[model samples]
Target chain A: MYLCISVLVVFFQMELLTLPALRRMAICGGTHGNEMTGVYLVQEMARRQKEEGDKAWPVPLVLVLSNPRAMQECRRYIETDLNRCFTSAILSFPITDSTPYEIRRAHELNALLGPKDSKEAVDVLCDLHNTTANMGVTLIAYSPNEWICLHIYKYLKGKMTLAPVRLFMVNIPKNEAYSLESVGKNGFSLEVGPQPHGVLRADIYNYMKEAIELSVEWIGLFNSGVMIEGGEVDAYVFHKSIDYPRDPESKQITAAVHPQLQDQDFCCLKSGDPVFLSFSGETVCYKEEEALYPFFINECAYYEKGIAFHLARKTTLKIPSVRVQRN
Target chain B: MYLCISVLVVFFQMELLTLPALRRMAICGGTHGNEMTGVYLVQEMARRQKEEGDKAWPVPLVLVLSNPRAMQECRRYIETDLNRCFTSAILSFPITDSTPYEIRRAHELNALLGPKDSKEAVDVLCDLHNTTANMGVTLIAYSPNEWICLHIYKYLKGKMTLAPVRLFMVNIPKNEAYSLESVGKNGFSLEVGPQPHGVLRADIYNYMKEAIELSVEWIGLFNSGVMIEGGEVDAYVFHKSIDYPRDPESKQITAAVHPQLQDQDFCCLKSGDPVFLSFSGETVCYKEEEALYPFFINECAYYEKGIAFHLARKTTLKIPSVRVQRN
Candidate 1:
């Protein structure tokens, strides 16, 4: 008689439980082919799902492995950067004659996860990435205006007991969007790194695995009406990109980042800090005069993209605590 | 009358001194242009020489920046691997029709450091190189038959207290020499590493500088009839190269090195040891049924060159004690 009452109560509540709920969740990986950690993690996760069967995540979760062809080549991308192909300017172009490989791939991806401009997109999307630069375990919000990403960042920060919590606000203009998360309603990318392409690093891979597991748990807890604590988050807002020193007549890069600042990423640099050293013994300084934090220092992938490093400024903000009313 | 008698005695003693000695020494760098530590150290040494005159070394020393044009571009080489261009078949080819840049450079270098097959070559030549592989402070003898190279190896081994020494006998049959050290009589390449190309790592640069200094000191001391000590040298002899596991029909690489064996360079691998793991969840073991040491494991530069790793075998050989007779 007790078990019969519990089943009857659950059946009645299924139609009524509406306010605090998780409808759908998606985790995408291998958007950029060279980042193997995400690709490997997703594969491992899929294998586990196959063996463990249907009752894993509380909500309907989707797994995406984007850019399979490029990953096969072991290069960043084949035709264009798949990560940068999500904008309408690229997507609206006819996919008929001579459409690039990444463009076609982007269209296919958007049909599943996007129409990023729509208000009724997926509940959350977490993209994973790895970089050749020394930025360690970074959580990036597309722009500072993203409230849900900030909420997720805050939750992850409070939960994680290892290493550190670094959140990036990549403030691209409101009209232009170029990332996998741009296609979703909420959440941000978690980038882990300093591992080279095609090389598997154990320390980095283990940390990312832990971060992903924590993210899934946080979403489940939220759906069960568990109130998540949120507060002041120390973040860095995007400033501008710094290109390596180049020659005037022949536009080739002619200098290297000064030996002192080689691996000094996310550290403050004042005005007149020697940045590059020329072949003929000339010192080039950071001429900005304001104290700015540098990131993505000497990224190998960015070498072909002509970016030496990027600058960001420190900022502080609060993620408002979320609540759902009892209907 | 007493001073004149002493001068006469010294002049006679100099003639009586009849031991074989090193006369001319040459130190070459930038043969592979992307190795910036050697290039920077050579430039710094040259600058110091300009400031301090020629009194630093006791012998006639020459510093050759082998590939200046390639170094300007911050690349490995211009036309061909300059290190590979010193062989007779290429060197003896006609320079008129369409000789490659490195081959022409090799001809010029031969006029200076070589005529390598002849007896009148530089008595000792030290080539400085750096790799993206995890080989730290390596002393490379072209083949094990080189007696003087072994003697020099023993001397450098006794000098360095920080790092363990690795000497590679890059086995090419008995003929067809392919290194810058192949031209000169009695020295080997001092390789420092795990540093990326075109990046100047201060720690690696300092270690190379110290290694170069000790090399020059060894040559100078040997010329003055020094009795150098020799003992058992732990050496790794080249076996063969191992390419990444690939699909036979598809011509694509299928796997990555196993997580446990990622950075296990210069370490022994026995039978049944998991070496490579496929994406489809299969482990490739070392099926050699014997123990072997792996070197240059997961080198970034060699990824494009299609080498997964190189195999070597460890051997203990005594470098015959070198003694120069005194008058």
Candidate 2:
């Protein structure tokens, strides 16, 4: 009887830890300016807010366009990648006249929506992004154990019918998480694609809009004292990134993503599978011993970052269910 | 007998006018720097020339990288589009300190490959280009009556098994022709694509390489006194350009190319067909009375040019058979 009582007490404490009511949320877009779906979605929402007012949302929500200058020029970024400038170390850097444009912008954003890792930060943040690679709809989380993000991914996976929904965990520590989404207490990014930079596709734009709507709906249900149930979700955990083959002397790429592997993101790649095709008509094969899922294959923005594609190992995550804690 | 003799004399003169052998040919690439197929093909040909000493060609061939500064930066152009700076009026514009970099580069290219409309110009010039639209292997010509270009287009249609080959005529007068191709006596552009700017696709690259190789082979056959047989071919003549729906106040695009029309280049569009989808979920239909084929649909580069797509009217042209004129 004593052992049973101890087990019940442990379960009660775990539910207490999981049930904080989310009071405020933030949705950010244009972190990478050339990703048009997010930029337009944010604009669309702002227009709707002006017309309908905030009575539609159950929780207080803030909309952000992260990089206005880059969006104006239809470029990925103006000075440096804004999405990569949000780690605590970088955010704390002393401001100078010669500081990069994105770094300064990061500080202003942190002050607005984040203090990063503080209780005053928004309860949740969803930063919208797009990729040239055919990744479909992906929820990218900084931590595998982020229950709010994982539950949202599970909900989106069940709701999204136009394309396959996936969860990808970058698995970085909270303090070292570098994306704009990391500013909030429970943050993640929704990345969708095959959309080209500086161009908009209606289908892709629709998919993104649907995703944001569903995400907001899920947040509302959880905040309104509804018991949100969670279960096991399969996530692709990032392993490593591969770079394209390049000429040693000139540093120019000597090959392109092989036709067989192009647009096959999230497919298991085994050893000896074709990965790249040299400009001289030679096929370069994957050399890894173990089979792994590949994603973000041949992303246009990653060319400058020296990443051809990223490899990830699939793992199942367990999520806890709970109702909002009563004061 | 007098009537028959007059007809024979006219036919003889026409054959004589068409039979001049192509002595010097130029292959130019990188007029738009983000077009990887052209940039890489030029680099590959240059490397081959260094290795093989140009002994493989049937005539003197010049391989030109038209805009080196733009190519270096991987942008469409440094200041102004190099391809549009080739008309006689623009080419003859006196050099000034404030002249756009591409305009200055155009003068240098014209000096090397042309003295346009003169016998000193290269006999044939083939410019390579790429577009973000699904325009499968197009030969863009300045005139419908350029038999050399028509015959080459026919030959490519026969030889290219990977993609459909079609001819597109801009029909601009020779003196006012605004593209780089018009610098030579007989010139046309080999445009292929659906490739994103700053990204390379192996299949698209191979299609372009095969097209260039077949063009050079056709040149060799003609220069060696072969009778090149020709036939009637369908060509799309430029009609008009359509712009995306935009807000009057900010001039910001309010719509994207509808999903139905996104990659449907060369497909016939009827009046009242779906064309643009507004951010507010409204369908904007095509309002033209006449049915027309559309190309360059949602081209990323054309966003700044205010072109959503270009319409064309399909017309058939007759090509003439000819053998080299010998001294």
Candidate 3:
């Protein structure tokens, strides 16, 4: 369980292995305070990489464990779910005098990933997380517009049991929301499986291990390459669900594919409606007559958009916040 | 203009002032690289506070300017708007290793505000900026519920020509996107006026000067007041704009309000246009609306459900890495 804490304390103290002329790739696990598979996998990877020596990782690999304190506590961040705090206005934890352990880790990781002046420090970022419900191995690559993301995906597909996914939607028009859609960077939230699920963690670990290897291969091909085999992934079967929350503000104007049921669900949504369920064990209810109800196409789970659904609303939905161009 | 170039360099050099008994408040100006009014005011306040010889601010004030480089460059954080980088992931700027200057400032401020271990910091975050089109003073408080916000509003109103004017719909389902929305915390984004035109540096200076003063007062109340006065601004304005971005992964399932446009606008939007523009710029052509349109509400604008127009969007939005639950 003991691992190499990154040496450079100013930034991220990633378990380090130095390789000259090497590109560094950072893999983030357990971005969700509740999702800890990524943390477990990254820790394993860091341990293995450290053991295998620098040559084992063709590139320098930084394994990041998001919200370690939360991970230890088995919740997201202690008081606040750290995943939401990444907006522009709010970066670290909301601590005035003493920050929670998680915020301090975030600052450290941020500095290490991209030190104030060191542009060439960490090159690639891959965020690993798990879903509340059952999900397959997937990569959330929101950096399609960028060649770096494209190449990373290629490598990822080539190496891992990844299912290529089109980001169904993003939380747009809001500040500091992170996703492939928001930050045009090549980062994805790997929805391995439900938290504390052993099978899911194993799957996540294997896939991440492969991803690190492929990430190195991808970086190797960046500037100089003989054009060897690139990466390709399986089609990730997505469960058709809009992860948007039923907030009072959005609820007013949001034309839920089914407006009537939307309110009811928001007001009193239980569990097991159809599309998705929340980690808090809330089920979404829906009417069979609505066009978007049950959220399935021809009995196949479809991830047309990417909002996590805690409950089902009986309605046809147009996914919002998916395609904002960075100006 | 030779104010101290080293102010940029001295950013990290300053020791993190840790005083747990002291309430924590961080005021950031120039989040938008070009918005300098808050910066001017904060610096002046810092100097005056020093001159007044207050050993410790009534509250430990963490004064920060978001984008020193962009401010120096005189443009919104170009590669990536720094404001948008705080969410789940710090975005990758176009130029590799080129994080927005504001992001760097955010990191530095986060550290200084609370080193995570300090016990006395209060994280009273205020981001100050200037808007070019609007001619009003606005505060975007980060109150999660209605009651607390009303108190924040009342306190702010007494300090300035403050009006609780709602701006163009933020697509966030709830107020989670703003840093201040966290419970028991005071975070707000202040918009002064049309940048470089309406508010001169001196005018901004006055605004900043008073803000620092009011912040001190507010902190003192929190620290020692038996019964805090003016606690009535808690009626939550739940206005959801059509533009709210929805991120399903966050633990807080809140919705945002969107404005319902008229026939003149969104005419092309059929009953089920998937990615419809709920609140595009009023002045711009229908076809011309993409993201980042300048469609602020004009004079004699209607204020229904507490929504505003013509206000600029924060750089980005996402789930905070931490989640806090309130009793």
Best by lDDT: 2
lDDT of 3 by residue, A1-327 (tens): 123333323223231222223256777766554454565556556657777888766666777776666665444446554555444454434546576555555555655664312454355677776543333444444322333544455556545654332222232442445431222123445554322211122334444456655666766654343333322222222224543334475341111122223212223333434432322224444534433322111110111132433322332221111111222
Q: Write the per-residue lDDT of candidate 2 for residues A154-200, one digit (tens) a residue.
A: 89999987888999999979889999999999999999998878889
- For candidate 3, give the lDDT: 0.42
Compose the digit string of candidate 1's lDDT tens values, residues B99-125: 888988988887798778778788888
Task: Note the Cα lDDT for every prediction shown.
Answer: 0.76, 0.89, 0.42
When summed lDDT is taken over every stretch of 10 residues in candidate 1 chain B, the lowest stretch is B10-19
lDDT of 2 by residue, B1-327 (tens): 999989756664465334788888899989998788888887877777778885856666799999888888778898988899989999889999999898989899889988888889998999999888889899999998787788788889999989989889999899999898999999999988888787888888889989988888888888888777655689999999999999999999999999999999999999999999999999999887999999999998999999999999999886667778886
The residue-by-residue lDDT of candidate 1 on A117-161, one tens digit each, is: 676667788888987667877898877756656766777677767
> Chain A only: TM-score of every candidate?
0.88, 0.94, 0.56
Task: Report clash pairs, candidate 2.
Answer: none
TM agreement with the true structure for every prediction: 0.71, 0.94, 0.33
Give the runs in model 2 whose Cα sits over 4 Å from its true position: A1-17, B1-17
